[model samples]
Target: MTTTQNQDTLERLREDYPGWRIWRSRRGTRPAGWVATSLTPQDGRAPTLHADTAEELELQLKNPPMGIGLDIPGQLEWSGGR
Candidate 1:
């Protein structure tokens, strides 16, 4: 996808999942992947997902039963912050 489209998707995910923290690399750092994390419902332990690309994140968003209420733009906003 185009850079603009990818950025929009990331922003949506951040708005959708407010509780989850998103991380991205700074200048000169390796573009490892995107990380979404939250406290476990059962024990309050941290649970996280690593997505290497926008496509993977989009797939996760499409599947709602996965328990993450993520939208594309939110994720983009979060990533852009970093």
Candidate 2:
């Protein structure tokens, strides 16, 4: 997992979703990857979404699932049609 990219993505999520707690976990040294999660009142024991990489996590933050109940402040500018 790229620490720089993971932290950057985490900060972006925090900025987009106030009051929602976000965190990241490294997928150990073997099959290297990172998992980012967001927890809210609507999400009981599980995260609202999980992403395998920093890039994917950023994408999820930009386009979250409907009815998650978290209020995002504004729209994110997408690039490359992703």
Question: Evaluated with TM-score, which candidate comes out highest?
Answer: 1
lDDT of each: 0.56, 0.58
Clashes of each: 18, 0
Instruction: Report the Cα lDDT for residue 52, model 1.
Output: 77
lDDT of 1 at 74: 36
The number of clashing residue pairs in model 1 is: 18
TM-score of 1: 0.45
Query: With candidate 2 superimposed using the best TM-score fit, by how many Å does residue 63's alpha carbon deviate from the native?
Result: 3.7
Give a tens-digit lDDT track for model 2, residues 1-82: 3567656767876787664566665456443443445455454323555667656755766666565444555755446797
| TM-score (all chains, Cα) for each model | 0.45, 0.43
Tell how far residue 71 is off in model 2, in angstroms. 21
Evaluate residue 25 in candidate 1 and report its C-alpha lDDT on the 0 to 100 scale.
33
lDDT of residue 53 for candidate 1: 78
Q: Which lDDT value does model 1 have at 3?
A: 58
